[model samples]
Target: MKGRRRWRGEHRRFAAVLVLYTLLLLLLVPYALDYGARRGRADEEPLLRRCPSLEEALSEWGWEQRPPLDEEEEEEDEAGTAGAAGNGSAGAAGKRHIYLHATWRTGSSFLGELFNQHPDVFYLYEPMWHLWQALYPGDALSLQGALRDMLRALFRCDFSVLRLYAAPPAPRDPLAPAPPAADNLTTASIFGWRTNKVICSPPLCPAAPRTRGEIGLVDGAACEEKCPPRALRELEAECRKYPVVVIKDVRLLELGALLPLLREPGLNLRVVQLFRDPRAVHNSRLKARQALLRESVQVLRSRHRAEPRGSPRHQQQHLLLPPGLLGGGRASQPQHRAEFFLGGALEVICQAWLRDLLLARRAPGWLRRRYTQLRYEDLVREPRAELRRLLRFAGLTVPPALEDFVLNMTRGAAYSSDRPFLISARDAREAVHAWRERLSRQQVRQVEAACGEAMSILAYPLSSGDAR
Candidate 1:
């Protein structure tokens, strides 16, 4: 009896040990997989990774002495050729993909229009907006991978990805006929499709006619009223016909998130990053505050979740900045919810811009050739000259009609504030500098405090009051 009792006790102990071991494996396996994935991840490295070259360059050259575009191009060209042997596959494909990387109220629409008006380029305006809309309340950081995947598919003229988010699934029971079909996505499902030149013009829509060698903007209102929605497959066919595909998006917050797409050899991807004065961007964001509130919240949520108090990197980033810059529960304040969320988002934006600037400054030779940065102020001030430089970088020659259109658009009759979001010709100079008149001194100071480091790098001088 004593021996049998001892055997039962040992069996219970062995079973308990087995259960604990199984639980540990279940928990540790996922963590191991995640760690391994991160180790091999091709996206941007840690934002705060030390770059000795960047530090030395900044100390020696000062902020205002950026290498001239021409000089930089020459250097990149010389270095790019060493790796050109492997790039022939993409070149032979005869499809060049460009992403206009910009955020809200940064003259991005105007910049995107430059490609949209080009007859040989198929431009998609904010297609990823569908993803953000479909996944509402999803943080911007979390959705970046999805954004890249969507871009990958779109660049290849594959419209099937759109169905994943654009169309709601049909009901399981066909006889009920209560819900929309799974394959119901159409041209109109795209964000800003009415203004898309390819969608508004021939083959897809008969609302506006296209002629050979024509470079003109599409009429959004007319397209909306007269054009019938076409199937997603039709848009895909039209996309395949173009040699250049340009996608403009404001949701991509960091250059690191996009490095994978940039490194993909088959895509032949190039990036044109557009930047505006932070103050001006903030002012415009406030003007459209209600419309941008959701996106602002999304961005702020990302910053909060990404930066934890225990992190050494997070501590270093906040050491110099003022308190509340991270928007910690600011949504609960007495101020407008839009202002609170937008304010926090601005800090994140500056952080991203500063990081991107540093990364670009120290980028490898091949990446340097593939990436170029543009300032909205400079582009507006020298429309013709800047346009030529921009076209050159994209491997495109300037057509006389496009040049004339750009000049006319910048030299508008007068500056109008009535329709801030509408894409129309405006007095570029006045529009660029309007922040001086609109923002309060305190507001300006806040922006300078948040963006001083980036503003300095971009050669935007501090206000006379702040003086460094």
Candidate 2:
């Protein structure tokens, strides 16, 4: 009887310990989950942060607070005096190339169409995107992710190309399934193309002798003519006159990879950074209504929340980025309409202002000097003056035709005014203060909260003459 009682007591004690351990784990599970989530997700903290910490910059408009950008006048002088850029007469041989660098919904398409007005510019519309999607599929990335990889891949590879929409030698189908063993980032046999001209690979074809320029999109030299003659002739003709080529598609925002082409000795390049009020941009996005807008909004929201003044380290440490940071999807809904128009719109404004503010604070002088900010409102208000400013910036003459084109377009007398030109009624009403009337009083506050840095950058004063 004594032995039996002792055994039962010991067993009960063990059971109690087991129960306690289980309960402890249960109690600790939420924290463990949070830790794991923080570790796993790059944007977990900002995702949780309410009212992004952007207010710190508000007191000084991010300009006063930031260190001044240093100029590289010497670098340009050295290049000019030392003949670093081909006897200091860049493109004197008539190799004119124009580049348009636009952020989303900033009237890029309209600008592209307008640029096409130049008798010389061919203005190819996003040719590289589809081909990029085809050539490199990775296991870790979605198909779209693979496309971005292909874009980055160009930096390491020969960049020569025919139609960027079609890969060299032609894949069986541009939209085929990604290859086996395809983790989203690794090259797959099907998606990966080997060419030393493109990157580190054996010769794509022996007859070609692996030249180190534009990556060929086909297997042979004769294939150079394979791209539609109309296209090539148009491009060549444009270069003959303007020497600079530009495609004003906001879609090409990731085109830093195209810098190699611009840097070549034969081309003189200027990139125009154009943008508009976010609500107008949101209106354009509204028209583009795509199902992916939800994801895009979530992404933009997170991006806006990240890198708040006090949290640069957090953003860098967490690797936080907007969805558009890597690439963009789309969104089309009333709320999303409101998101971009209202919420997403503020984020875009922040980005544009922040980019200019940051670049002014950090980039080299020539680049800073070379960069031009063309707000759509400025164009709308004074098209001739703005056009002249643009011409002067681009080192082009103030041609009568160009001036007339601007006059005609702004007067609502030219080229399909029926189609919205990426502006809201309010956008036409006021440049910075347009949001005041469009959004509800509460809605305005939400935007204010979201866009806490406005008073400093856009000259938006403190909210409410009285309400605060």
Candidate 3:
């Protein structure tokens, strides 16, 4: 009996040590990852961040910087055979790059606004798109160093979203003793608008939601007496201390072709795909281009006639219900089907959209698993529910402050018509149905026939008329 008791005690001791060992490994992992990444040699190490280095991420889309390559860099380029490959110089871990994959007019602006409100989220008003909108029209030259600075801004904003995780920037209390090297990091105004694209917003005039291609100067003379290189080095050193960061831009969805160049596996990014029904989308699109919407109506009508019914590649086919059916079918107006106007360039857009969705669905399972899908209906109707899900998706907690704000904001929602769709439970359910009233009968039929496969997959009904 004495020997048996002694043996049991020995086993218990071994188990306790094993548990402690596992705990130690768990606690040290992030630090180990953080340390190994930052301290590694710069020349050969690939920085592992979540954001990709794409042309959209660059100041110039697809324009390679012709920095008078130093003899050594030129030799490296020759050995690599082209500029297509990048040197392993910028390897940092956990850099979050967020691309809002959304169709135009899908309440994307509102979504952007929500993200911008997060104190930690460095809200960029379409960082990658200035090249096409402001810079190109203004004919700004994309120089090598300027381009580098542009990337630095992208990187800084990308990392700043990990606001609490990383150490705060220097000069926090400039008079105090400097923080430890392990705890320091650098962030530029791109994280804080160090250099922002000069938006020509008329006083109180809501800036048009589009990128302007103009050469934007570093705001307030980053050019005049810029922070010293040694200071920047110190900043990078501190930045390296954190394991992860995040950056967001909605324009990447507009320029879908630029995706490959932007994907950076070293960054460990999680991509989000957001979408909304087309009629609402088109309505908003029309609103944004009032004159064009007026002109396009005639064109849209003519184009609507050319497409055949019962064929594939249509938009908003199944969700249409008569106006009488709206609001528990109480109102007196006859609701028409939205798919009735489903052809021409509109059809083209719808079809292209479906294609992108399919491609996004099939993206490498690795990226696909990381990709999250959110419909406008889900978010607007139950902001708290949706936000909670999103927090879990991002592995974040639903802090009390955010929870309180979301709860209050969603309680007495008035989103429809003006905000529309997002505020009402009926609109949320009938979101895709807007096409019934918005589109012609033929347009509805044609779109239904065309996109039946995708509709089924997305769990949309075929048509309201089928019930009759």
Candidate 4:
């Protein structure tokens, strides 16, 4: 009986020991993982480590706090400098190539449409869409080279560069399952090509092509029905007929990425960067969260892949580094996967914008002359004045019809929520402030936290926990 009692006592002690061990493991595992992560990141540069302070950036860029950007004065100054702005190595060519450098949901479509309406401009909407779709699941950084090459080719009116991403022909039936890969890319493969003025109008389509230079919207379905798929070579032929070529894309993240194309003597590239309030952008992104998931994942992928430590490439890429240390905690899965990724991508975008702001501030005279910045709020608030300035910058004159179109497009009936991605008319003011009503306080705070640096520089006021 004594032996049996001793055995029971020993069993209780063992159970107590096992419980203690399990509790110890539970406590230590998280710390162990965190320590490992910190050690791994020790060699990697923190995203903000290399970024200069706002004061430093502003000082180096030669600007005071919130200095007004008077375009007329700047233009006069640029004109006085002999070879500052418009003069490139290929200044003799007298051709203008404009890249609408913007990210998604920044009202870039509306801006691109302005150029598309101009008779002198041949516009392509997201030509890089083909590259992105063909190389889906590839990180954004890995595709920058191909994007640059493709842009160079497209600017020169060479369509063969697209052949690199060509896939099998699309199915004849509309309902047929799309080939597991992206649809075959031809002249028609460019995203939103159906609405492209040049593609939908004469010589390409029989649809009573709208009057030349008439500022109007194209019905995509009607255009698709009227216009048959043309060969890529034919598209190239059409591209060369215009004096100005404008391509709008959201894929190009960094301004520095375009430095090579900017320096090319054959293409006199002018960059117009568009920015929107980060909170508004974040709200719109959430509204279309699911659609943006894949791209967001691809963008966030770059942050995880560490470059060679202390290499020149590593140092160079820091400017474009997606947010590394800021908000770099493991994403919780309680929310939809898309929301998490979209939020993370927004952080990446803000970091990118901060870098661009710094780079532009310190850019040389020639580059400064070629670059222009536009805000969505400013564009909508004063469409006519802004449009005039934009046209002058592009070396084109604004027409009354274009002016009327801009006015009507921004003064629509309401901000339509059903078709978030549609490029239809809407009240621009309402659209700009929609975030105040839509985003929860928490959501606003999160975006503010992530984009605080860029917002401050751009003069965007932060929320006061009262964003109902």
TM-score to native of every candidate shown:
0.75, 0.50, 0.45, 0.73
Q: At residue 344, what lDDT does model 1 achieve?
A: 76
lDDT of each: 0.76, 0.43, 0.42, 0.75
State residue 276's C-alpha deviation in candidate 2, in Å: 1.8
Off by over 4 Å in 4: 1-93, 169-185, 304-335
RMSD of 3: 24.5
User: Which 10-residue span in candidate 4 carries the lowest summed lDDT?
Assistant: 317-326
lDDT of 4 by residue, 403-441 (tens): 999999889999864877778778988988999999877
In model 2, the Cα lDDT at residue 466 comes to 31
Query: What local lDDT does model 4 show for residue 439?
Result: 81
Worst 10 residues of 1 by lDDT: 82-91
Question: Which residue ranges in model 2 land beyond 4 Å of their true spot?
Answer: 1-96, 120-122, 128-241, 252-267, 291-349, 413-418, 421-437, 452-455, 458-468
lDDT tens per residue, model 1, 1-468? 999999999999999999999999999999999988887875745323464433433333233233223456556543443333234221233567899999999999999988887766788889898788889899887888889989999999998988788776556887966766658778886858878877887766654665424777777788888779998888888888776788999998776667777766668788999999998898888888878888988888887543323435543343222234445644354345567678778877887787678878867666788889999988888988988777666655567898998988898866655777788888988888778888777678888877888899999987775312
Enumerate clash totals for all models, in the order shown: 0, 30, 50, 0
Who wins the lDDT comparison?
1
Give the per-residue lDDT digits (tens) of candidate 3, residues 232-319: 3434443343322333443332223433324443443455667665444554443344322322233344332223333443443333
Ranking by TM-score: 1, 4, 2, 3
Question: Candidate 2 residues 137-247, lDDT tens each?
Answer: 321112323333443333222232323434334347879764432122212112112211221111222344433222222242342322111223222332333333444
Q: What is the lDDT of candidate 2?
A: 0.43
Candidate topping TM-score: 1
